[model samples]
Target chain A: MTHDLTTLVPLPVLIPLCAAGLALALHRHPRAQRTISVVALSLMLAASLGLLVAADGGPLVVDVGGWAAPVGINLVADRLAALMLSVSGVVLLCVLLYSLSEGMTESADGLPTPGGEDPIPVAIYHPTYLVLAAGVANAFLSGDLFNLYVGFEILLAASYVLLTLGGTGARIRAGAVYVVVSLLSSILFFVAIALAYAATGTVNLAQLAQRIPEIDPGVALLLELLLLLAFGIKAAIFPLSAWLPDSYPTAPAPVTAVFAGLLTKVGVYAIIRTQTLLFPDSPGVDRVLMVLALLTMVVGILGAVAQDDLKRLLSFTLVSHIGYMIFGVGLASEAGMAAAVFYVAHHITVQTALFLVTGLVERRAGTTSLDHLGGLARVAPGLAVLFFIPAMNLAGIPPLSGFLGKVGLLESGVRDGGTLAWVLVAGSVVTSLLTLYAVVKAWNKAFWQEVPAGVTRDVRLPRGMVGPTTALVAFGVLLTVVAGPLYGYADRAARTSMDGHTYVDAVFPGGSERGRGESPEAGGGDP
Target chain B: MNPEMVPSGVLVVAIGVLFAAGVYLLLERSLTRVLLGFILVGNGANLLMLVAGGRAGGAPIAGITPVDEMSDPLAQAMVLTSIVITLALTAFVLAMAYRSWQLNGHDEVADDVEDRRIARLAARNAPVYRDVDQGEAGTLDEDAAAARDETERDEAGDKTGEAT
Candidate 1:
């Protein structure tokens, strides 16, 4: 059964990549491009779901191109990876559908005249979106450190194109800041990987997990710090987050929704993988992480509270909610890790749904500015319900997955009983309340306030656009309904990751020294 | 670990200098300079990977070079991959920079509109400085008083005048 599942490991990455090539080739045939993209992503989602179920037994590892663990790249779909892959697959599919529907309406409107020419280059969008999906899958499933880096580059490259899709003045400016910052982070990550290889003589994650403990404490700490800094920038942890709000709001709504949902979460996922699998017991680093998490929550929400633009406000809230995941990781306990994983899943759905709803608002109301938006509740009652559910879910109102995840984190924090954990607990509650304030402020302005002049209320929302968004919001609600089993699976995943040996042993079943590769020196030579 | 595989001091220094210069250039506002800085830093990182592979040796060929004499093939492979990635990214950034220039007539990184707005607000709300604390020569307090409701201020002023 495990061997059978291992064959499915590469499908999520492979199918989309192959489809991307096909999509690019068929760019002239927009219908064919759409069909190929939809089919490829649906198959990827199926594979991810299969992996999610199979990986629950244990990690399923595949050595790509028949190369073994140490010498060759591998993809491992452990529980955490499988869970992340599944959520991302769902999100990518929904966003793709939303964009496709959007493109259809846009073409129908005949807005792309001689000068304006379609803000989103429709021909390239499918291929780039597919590549982005593949990249995200690769990042989640990669068992090798260097392969993870490759995955990051793939996704980031796609993101750059998406962010500056139309090459408008604002998008170009936003893309410049985004591209520069991401490049810097990538460079830092590369440096860290190089140094890690120097110290450990291997870039394979399983081998590193074995060898890292034997290295000098100071060198190990340096590697840890370097990796954290690199991932922190990607994850947009407090101090490294300024670029996100500025860059994200400039993109088209579907693109922004996907980025808001998946991109930074990839960084957070990396942090969880490394901190749990590679460096499991460092209280001092954990303490520092706690402090940073506290600041990220407070500062990010404060920024959110101050935003007049709805997209920008959502972006800030996205940054703020990342703090909760960091808080869970900072606790460095199984319970905390479980809650973090669950919270990550919850946040991805809720945040994406909110952004999609914002897109619908922009379509119906003509803008996403809180100051200009008004009477949406009276104008579009269904849209109001859609926005209200996800908005409340994000703010962690009772009976929602967001609230459940937060409660789990807070419970874990109290159990840890450390002063820093206590402070973070307090910080999280305050952040939650402030999030409520920010979203409510947006709600009141956008939904309840009198309609601003010159804004049309009679615009119709296309069924195609609303269908996928509604499905996604319903998926968010489904997370609340299935919270029990999901949290249980998360707990088991947390246990497996925190233990570390299960992952390493899965990669090198016999022992730490050898893989199936024929190379005499399976692991790399030492410096 | 091999005793003879120590990295050269000169190489390490070169890496440091490249990184320092790259970071300095990175802080500049122009997208062109930032792209150049990224290329420099990327090269420095590639060199660091080379250094990580230990002392240079013969090409890592199975039959052409002995095992002991062969350089670390893995590091070389990684460096080559990174170099390709950096090159691709360089092309993309160049395109973006050109696009930026075409759109705005310049390729300088612009400040975030929201951040700039906040900065402007902070400047406006900043407290004014006065040389003398008690003097009424355009003091901040006097300004506040002048800005207050005229009727309320007159009543308070009359009361204070009577006390004086």
Candidate 2:
């Protein structure tokens, strides 16, 4: 009478992994491959939703190859993992749908339609996109450090292909930098894992949690630092964030939006996991994190302010706003972590929505350069309304998810009232103001002002493309409206992550570090 | 313990030197030098990992327990993974260099700030003629002809000597 819902755990990873191979096979059969990719992704989205429902009250752990605890790698999906995965699934589904609707070929209306000379085939874009989404899901669900590294490689490999899909001169050049930096970070991650393994003899995050405490304090600190450096590079924390804005804006709108929305946050998520689970006792890490958070905020927004290109400006702000999440994590309070988790969810939606809106703006206005785009509201009032809500939310205005996430972090920081927390609080307020200014600058230039004389009227995006952008924006606003439920989920996730014992016991049984923790039979039988 | 006690300390210092030099070269605009810098950084990071693995002795293989030590196999494995990834990246970046050289006729990084300003200026003052041709021309491929038509219109308008 077993329903075998746990079988769903590996399906999300397996589907995409298989799709990557299938995608390569269908490279020749472009249409069939696209069908397979889209179907596979849709199934994955459905599976992710089911897992979310099943995991509503508790953690779901899948031990691979039927191996027992501590030896077999595990994939654990808790509330935070489930929420991130759900958002990623939904957003990617929208992007894939939009890509299909728009047709893979055509340059925001600049290129000829399909069946014309040099058809822009959907084949290359769709499959690689699925692979990317799959990698994101794997990263979110992985319970082992080494497995997470592999997930990152999967994502990076697919992104490298996607980023260079067009093989344009600019794209190739940008992809080159993006690929190299990502590879370097991956290597660093390997090094960090090696060190951690040396100290703990295991790569399972749960096992490491129990063992890391026994390792020499100095060695543990060194390992933590190495791991932090690696993840920080990926997340594009203040100092290591330089490669992002330069590379992201070079890709097509969907590619850029997905990368901006999901990829860096993966890095941030990794950092959160490592700090909370692996080295919770690492002294002075929070202080370092606080300082880095502030710098990330200041430098990122300043970079955004200086950019004239709408996409590039948004990209900078994307990196800058990462500081808020990092700040919440650095606070190391339960409220702080919950706020950080909520912020991650909120930012992913708003950021993705904004980027998609930018694509629409580019399509209608002939470019994303604010100076060149003026008075867009006059001709494209639909676009103006579409872009405005997320734009205001991004600047942290009230009733939106963005503002709620920010307020959560600021309140936690202010409540903590340490010097680092004070700095974070002050920096949060300042960065929000600066963020508002940057977004308004874009609005004034692109929407409010009179349309410049030289602008063309020929730019017309398909209904399919606009539909996704509008949907994501509406979805973000909905989250803002339904803040209570989302916050409760985030709070639960934060509490569970900090508890560590609940997570620890789920992977082990009597072997757990939790004193009163329930065993496998008491909850769900291991068999 | 003195920092100079281990003979491998020199290798560690060498790693530092590689890092500093690589970072300096990476900052340069030239593509080849940047590639070289990346290689150097890779090596330095590898050395750093190896050093962190503990005093190196012999090659680390399984089932070997020596007198108080074994060449930290974990570090060796880490280095191996990193080496493979670095090799892949090096090959990929070289391909990029080749393509960039083919397209731009130079391997230096583009001056993004300066180019952006120029692009902004050009976009801001785009002629009235550009807009008119866009109305009639269906695509960007006909952009040049569109610009030409718009320029002709502007000239004709100028000839009429009426400012609208």
Candidate 3:
């Protein structure tokens, strides 16, 4: 049934973007707005799954406005993009459910009251969040550099709204920092795109993949460096990552969770895409990536150890684990890339689930600070269970998907053995163990430790919140249950990425060399 | 393809200066300056696209200018797109600065308490601390004293004592 569902490829992105406007228009009727968003994302998830299935057979490409590749904007749903889209769709759906359950769409307060006085607050969150999802989908599906930039901007603009939902002092403070940092990254990205177009006279990824390798060595290196810098800031690699630990923890829980789970991964995805597709054979560049990977892992985990706040600890670990993916990327091997893809999928699910559980912790205890939070296990075993599963999974506990991902990556790292690879391998293990220690410490303090004298112990456990948490946790476990198949998918996707010619052909069908600007042919250059 | 209306050399120098100034302002504590620096960088990038288009000849307007005679229209489109993006995002940042001022009466992006603590600790870990013992041995050097004074400054700069 999904054999020829290429037509469904663009629907995942197009639906949510159109729904964002529809949702905003119906903001006065939040029920209608909620219905629109839920219906739209549900459709997105379904279509994305279908696309994922179809893309496994082959990549699907579409040119918007009937324009050809190189001239018109294109959307390509290859295996990796399909995996990202489907997984993110599921995550977004769960987050939206959690938000609705938590009354994030209803009141100025995190808590819900029937018919709250403030209309704009409730009205704004749904549309912006959907727009953010749309932007993410657009980025994954976009086949051109300019469209990718547009995708980043779409999500970032939505994120500005999401980050400062309540306009509280700390939220505003953090939101300002996030906006500024993100703006800088986007501007750099814009500059990079311009420079790339100036050099190659084309912004299409497939075409660039063909032309970049043939360009002047100096210009090519400069373009690659510029792109790396832009994406590095976006991905928050070690030296460039300081802004993340500060900006992320201050947003409301679901927003923070979504940002952590999918936003940074988008940057990582772009890195993987550009490095493999555009500048595939840069050996020196791979080494530099390896060094950065090692540093990001060690520094991020050590920072996690020093944190007393659960959210901050998770944020650090988030940065640390990005190193693991980079390790895979740096290996520049099929196995390495496969493992990286698998790890990205696993991390996104587990991280979002952790933050969702953290939100529950906040809702139940009024804080996530380990100093104030204690004995959660005794009062709320269910919340403790919810937190414990994803937390352990995040720490790479055996039999969980996280462990499987780590082992896959380690195996690949060991296979791609060199001095740098070995160092990265050691760094990955250390990061894993430190991650375990940090989460365990949280487990000891927030769950197992004695309840403090004055701290509030029991609170209403809303199913709206708890139910989605359980669902996501179950999904994480399910990844483990299907590890064999999921890893296979990752391996295949990585193989596809390793083979760049397929991507170019899928986009151009009959090679980009044939099209030498008919207009340019009319003007001066060879016809 | 329009004749290289803007000299390539001038644009590269302008972009370099603009990018340098943008990076400088971004490093500062002030949000307004950061915005201005970003604007400069954006204009510089736009100029770069123009230079990338090759020596311009004419506008690549269909049914009019010959293709070979035309300026690179795609490059022009991308620049227009980037300009729009920069304008929108810069406005958003301006709003963010305004909100921050309204909330805290400052446009500075304050370093997180945890980050400051980490920095202070890292600063303390410098090899200069090993010279504290060296000072007792008759070589109370400038490096050691400077390091000590820097630590003292960090201690004074942060009012909240470390808890752990």
Candidate 4:
């Protein structure tokens, strides 16, 4: 059945946001709140799928309050957006299920409650989780740049609550860093948006696509640079990524999973949108992106290598791998953008799976430190397998999604035939080898060594936890096998991105040429 | 376009100064000072926004004034949005700080100087174990640094233990 736009577009964002209010109000009723959270997310998943199918090649745009383009707020969902929303929905579902199980068991077993009075710490978890999910969904679906900023605010606001959900000292200290850095980034993002709107007199992506090209070369560069800096800080590129590793690993496992899964990708998505739609040049912005990608790759992986904690190592690896996707964007060709899209999808699944596996490690070993954890393979072969597949994939081992994505990126970079492209190709190759080493280090230290004494090894995997972990792992594996069809989708997405005329037409029909304000020939000679 | 009026470069320098100050104060021990630093930094960023948008308009909304006479109202709207977000962020941070003080008995990064020092001293005082003892199976590992620190604190019978 065909989906109605009015119902589908708004519900995906509105349901969880509404559920956040509901969850907060029903704080005393733990089960009711949890049920409501699940129901809201489930509906979001359905709606996201509906929109994805409906908006495969084309886009779905609805101007809120009946305002026309350039004046009113619009919510547009193209294939890339739809793909992100679907990925976010799946990850949120997994995280929610895992949280529910963890919360229930902890509540029942007399785990040291946060407030000491509330036996079930349901009051805190439910509302915050719902809000975080709502924020993520909003971010994925938002059309206008300002609207996306709002979505980011919603997500980060909820994240502030989630990061410090438990008032532990470590969580508090880490939460402080998270809040300050995030605040700074938000401020920068606001400034960028303000500058962009001033320069172009428009905030809508399609409208900005029309106006930005006509702007002076210097002005255009400033706006693009400002926006890039804001997004870069959020995306955790090499120099901008210090706060992430320090803060992310300290939060609860489920929160960490969701954050790792969806948040940074939103930043990457924004960069891709701005780079492709706003400025399409062979060497101008693409060169800068290429440098950032290479540095982000090399530095992030090296940081990962130094970390003794599994979660910290993963966090660093997270930053390192962002380079691959950024490299894809840097190429600015159809294949390059396509490879980036493919990498983003692959990275989300693999990264989220790896974080969830850390949760499993935390549970079985009683600590996430590589020094403290050992012989997990012998004690818990199932958990070992769970970790191994994604670990191998993340390292770009053969017959996995990571390998397919990197190969696509590398091939595209090689074909692009620029100095930046060659650097990206070589950087990714080096990153892959380093990533493999880091993964091997974690495996050898945590899974292959002898177990310490006085630790009664409970290798028995929890029924509740294993389900979500297995599902994520299977999804990553499926991406590997289904690379052909997935690549076809990416190919279409990349073409639409490169040829902004298609996206502009999707947003403003009969005004396609009108939307491209200044022709490339009229502008600073194609940079 | 008037360099004799407001120099945009000064605003950039101001943003740099504000960011430097914010980063410095945010790294300080006191939570309150950190909050003030953030506020300053935020204001500086908002000023930067004002500059970036070409520094030439009142607001972007229509119907309030003559179309030709009106300023870039978009920057004004952005300022309003940034103000709202900053207020919300400040409130959240304050709430977190209050909650943290209640939980940990201090607003400083380190919860208690004396206790932390004592714990470190106790760790220095304790004997290190190279090998895990099989006999200690089922019994908690005394050599476990974290657990040992906890035991040391418990043995010290300090006032900080009561906070927990």
lDDT of each: 0.87, 0.76, 0.81, 0.76
Q: Write the per-residue lDDT of candidate 3 for residues A48-127, one digit (tens) a residue.
A: 99888888877788777656677777888888999999899989999998888676633433433434565567788888
What is the DockQ of the complex in model 3? 0.27
By TM-score, the better pick of 1 and 3 is 1
For model 1, what share of native contacts is present?
Answer: 0.63
Summed backbone clashes in each candidate are: 0, 2, 13, 2
Q: List-wise, what DockQ does each model earn?
A: 0.27, 0.13, 0.27, 0.24
lDDT of 3 by residue, B22-65 (tens): 78887866677788877887787788777777776687887789
Q: How do all models score by TM-score?
A: 0.92, 0.83, 0.90, 0.84
B28-144 in candidate 1: lDDT tens per residue?
Answer: 877889999999999999999999998889999889999899998899999999999999999999999888667555567776665444454477895343222122333211222
Q: What are the candidates' interface root-mean-square deviations? A: 9.7, 7.4, 9.6, 6.4
Question: Model 2: runs farther than 4 Å from truth?
Answer: A1-3, A106-121, A512-527, B1-88, B114-164
Best by lDDT: 1
Model 4 misplaced stretches (Cα beyond 4 Å): A1-3, A104-121, A512-527, B1-29, B45-74, B100-164
Model 2 clashes, total count: 2
Candidate 1 clashes between residue pairs 3 or more apart in a chain or in different chains: none
Q: Distance from true position, residue B126, model 4, in Å?
A: 22
> Model 1, A1-527: lDDT tens per residue?
43556788899999999999999999899899999999999999999999999889888888786667887787888999999999999999999999887882233222222224453488889999999999999999999999999999999999999988877666777788899999999999999999999998989899999999998999999999899999999999999999999899878889999999999999999999999988997999999899999999999999888777788899999999999999999999999999999999999999999999999998887677677789999989999999999999999999999999999999999999998999999999999999999999999999998887888757788898899999999999999999999999999999999997989988887665664368532221110
